[model samples]
Target: MLKEQFKQLAIGVAAFTFSCATAKAATTITVAVTPTAANAIVDLVADFVNANPTYDVAVVGSSDSLSKDAIVAGGATGPYDLLLAQSYSVPANLKYYYPTLVSGDPFPFAKDTLVLYSTTVDISQGIPLQLQAFSLPDPATADPYGVAAVQALGPEYLYAQGQSLTIKTADAGGSYAQVAYLGTAYGFTGKSQICTAVTNVDQYEPGSFHHEYVLGQDYTTDIVLAGVKIARTRTVDQETALTAFVNFLVSAKATALQHHCYKLPSAQ
Candidate 1:
């Protein structure tokens, strides 16, 4: 009788371990996003997990183009189950897994506008005489914002006129940081970025910066943001979770959060 009781106890323990492992596996989802939207995305994930306690989500953020490239390279079975990226790149990036996409469509999330930020207190002084350099994202590469910046600034005319506009380029986040902290005379970035800097200025070294809207005639483009989910190559449970998360992103609560951060929701 004692030997039989011990055998039953061992079986119960094995079953319990397997159940725990399976439950753990079912509760996690991975998402990739661009740096411009990282903060808002992180907040959204937190709220999502809180509302759905049974699930856990992780967010990975990088440059917009890089994030799209990584997801594309991963194909249908990539590390990420969903992608939040700039609107322009979504269609191209998800081309590989297009047929298998959750809805096979990209959902518009938000809109952003280009703006000019300057460390100088007054930008009305014609780009500041003390300004030795102008900084922006690289237009030749992956950044749509960079291309917009080039259209706004007309670099060729400035260069031809022998202006001391030392052109500097970096990713969007890097450009914002350089202007905010490194004393770059002028930097071009999204309006959301400038808003973030304004709200978080006290955390940086003592200084003042100003921002001006780059008119449509200047930038000649608009920025729209969107998100997409890859089809479930994992499990039906994961597919349901991904769909729910994507829906939440476009819901009123999430839209309000994005709006508070100076991003205009697509619905607007």
Candidate 2:
């Protein structure tokens, strides 16, 4: 009876030790990202998690808004392990406004091109002033895609300074506006948002017959997507996880996923 009790206690201790080991191996890395990358990271995190069973990725916020949140929280990364945006603005702001939060130089992972897409109007001739243009991403916020669209559309189409505008606002002509998104029927958006199967991923690449919409032009502007690590308040586990994820963003595995909606500088 004494021997049996000792054996049972040993087994229970071993099982508890195994459970602790497994729990320690699991690490979750949170990323603050722009709209496009937010959707793209779903596939990316799946692949990353597959490769490194111990790690998982969670996403939150626009690149600019999240940075503002971090600044408000103090010179820290806040809740995110990384920041991925459509331009250099995230790192640039952190560098000038809050340098201590940054871990290293930001790196571009993919290039997205702007295109005029329309399901309601024939856009072959370009910029149908008849319907006018709606607000786009705020250029003041340094959204590169919105900046490109606003710049290419010129003053006539730009109606406001922020995102999500109505036709009434476009008619009023406040300032500059973003064309792509749900509210506007016909407007400019990233090529990656439309591209599904094509592998080349050039900025000017035409959409295939399967596309639900019509193209206005060959292409407009090339937008770059960049990511950076946040150094402050990082744990030993996150230090390893962040490095692996950043390296993976630029790796061949991520290249194909990014190419689904964008072009790499080397590929271009």
Candidate 3:
């Protein structure tokens, strides 16, 4: 009976040791991104984790103010080790906020085109002459895509942007919802969201296809995304893991994923 008890105790200790080792082997870092890049970041983080088992990346979607506020609030050793925002301005802004905390130029990753899409009506007429009611991201907000959408519509339609009848939301996802689900005439959204229709994906499938008008330089503003590696006091393991993930983001595979349906930073 004593021998059996001894054997059980040995197994318990072994299990605890193994568990502790497994936990130590893994290092996690957070990458705060704007909502426009959330899906792309998720896919990219998945690839990074699969390649480096020692690292786990957490993706957080932030608004313009919230994005910078989070890092500033966290200080030098913040939760966000990296930041991927809708435009290159983010890095510049960070530099202004805390010069020492931000190092190096922001990496231009991808450019997302703004698109006008509709399922309930025809938009082939080009920019609508008038809208009884419309849906869009609030142009007043600092969201790059939303501002680009307003710029695409031009001054004649500025009132339409703030009209009481229009539906305004936070990000591209909400703009998509206004038209895709809520049936709000037509709306503006990111090209990445609708590129390459997938099976059973709502509004992107064969049956629920949306008529899309791709707005290029002739119609809309350029929407490029950039990421900046933040400098923070971290453990050696965490810093190494963070460097590896950032390197992977610029890798060929990651670049392709980031540019899926969008322009490569180098391309434009």
In order, what is each prediction's RMSD in angstroms? 13.5, 14.2, 12.3
Give lDDT tens digits, candidate 2, residues 185-239: 5555555554543355333223321122222343244477777777657677867
Best by lDDT: 3
Tell me model 3's lDDT, rounded to 2 decimals.
0.64
Winner by lDDT between candidate 3 and candidate 1: 3
What does the lDDT read for residue 32 in candidate 3? Answer: 78
Error of 2 at 170 (Å): 14
Candidate 3 has a TM-score of: 0.78
Clash counts per candidate, in order, are 0, 7, 0
| Of 1 and 2, the candidate ranking higher by TM-score | 1
Superposed by TM-score, candidate 3 places the C-alpha of residue 225 at a distance from the truth, in angstroms, of 1.1
Q: Which order, best to worst by TM-score?
A: 3, 1, 2
Scored by lDDT, model 1 comes in at 0.59
Q: State in Å the error of residue 167, model 1.
A: 3.7
lDDT of 1 by residue, 168-267 (tens): 4555555666666567776776665645332433121134454555547566666677777765466766777777877778776564345324454635
Query: Candidate 2's error at 128, in angstroms?
Result: 2.8
Please say which candidate is ahead in TM-score: 1 or 3. 3
